[model samples]
Target: MKKMILSALMLAGLVSCQQDFNPGTNGSSLTVRSGTSFGMCVGYCRQEVVIDNKNTVFTKTSREADKNPPVTCEKQTDSGTWNEIATKVNFDAFQKIPETLGCPDCADGGAEYVEIQLNDSRHRVTFEYNKTIPGFEDLVTAVRQQRNAFADCK
Candidate 1:
């Protein structure tokens, strides 16, 4: 009976440790991505930018792409450019934002989404277009500002 009880306690301890584990702080490589998506737009309705430790990519999706042409612009970002953008992002501030920023009364027709993958955790949030939390607006601006930098990359 003593051996059986000890085994059960050891198993329970292991399970508890596993439950507290988080992959995001494992010091692994990660990428942070943010973008805006709006439906029924004229051109380039959807734009998304993704930034990894040393690389970034900006993709533009137009309405015509749905047909046969599949219009899109994909740019490979330089490390320096991505690094500059990284400086602007505040992961702590981002994590503070609520999981979801919904504007039910805004009557907005579009939405914006932000996703951050650090180490082993992925945090994503969506808010109504033209509406955002206080500090979130700055974060979103920093994330979206990379568009021009990526466009100029050669």
Candidate 2:
């Protein structure tokens, strides 16, 4: 009887812990935007993805000199997907990161950026393309995966 009671208590504790870790239950709206750009390239020099509470939008554009219009595609975002990325966000730590890191797009090596807007606050961090930021590896990976999934967007 004691074993059974202890098991039940342990299960209840885990359930409450999970609820606390679930960002979706907090009732705050979140938006994540990630993008890459090249300073000295032509033909789709920029690509970006924006993930909001309800949808994910991807856009690719050419430089003004190329005279090409932007191309975009979008799809609905489910709660599972949102939660996956939202759980990676540590707003307090993110706010401490500098607005810019490394020499972005220096010598046309390319540049990447991630921006997040949660509730009434917004922050952006830009860095050299393909370079990993110390504390943001997981969040960056999640955003990159979402962006790459839309690579064939027209």
Best by TM-score: 2
Cα lDDT tens digits, model 2, 1-154, are 9999999999999866422223746635678899999999978999999997689999999977347889999999877888888888876678779989999999998999999887668889999999866798998998999999998887
TM-score (C-alpha) between model 1 and the true structure: 0.59
lDDT of each: 0.62, 0.84
- Total clashing pairs in model 2: 0
- What lDDT score goes with residue 53 in model 2? 66
Error of model 1, residue 99, in angstroms: 3.2
Off by over 4 Å in 1: 1-28, 62-81, 88-93, 104-108, 148-154
**What is the C-alpha local distance difference test score of candidate 1?**
0.62
Model 2 Cα displacement at 47 (Å)? 1.0
**lDDT tens readout by residue for model 1, 1-154:** 9999999999999866442213234323556677677776676666677876555677767678665333334555565655554554555556777877885224437877787776566678778765655665665676767754555432
List the pairs of residues colliding in candidate 1: 24-120
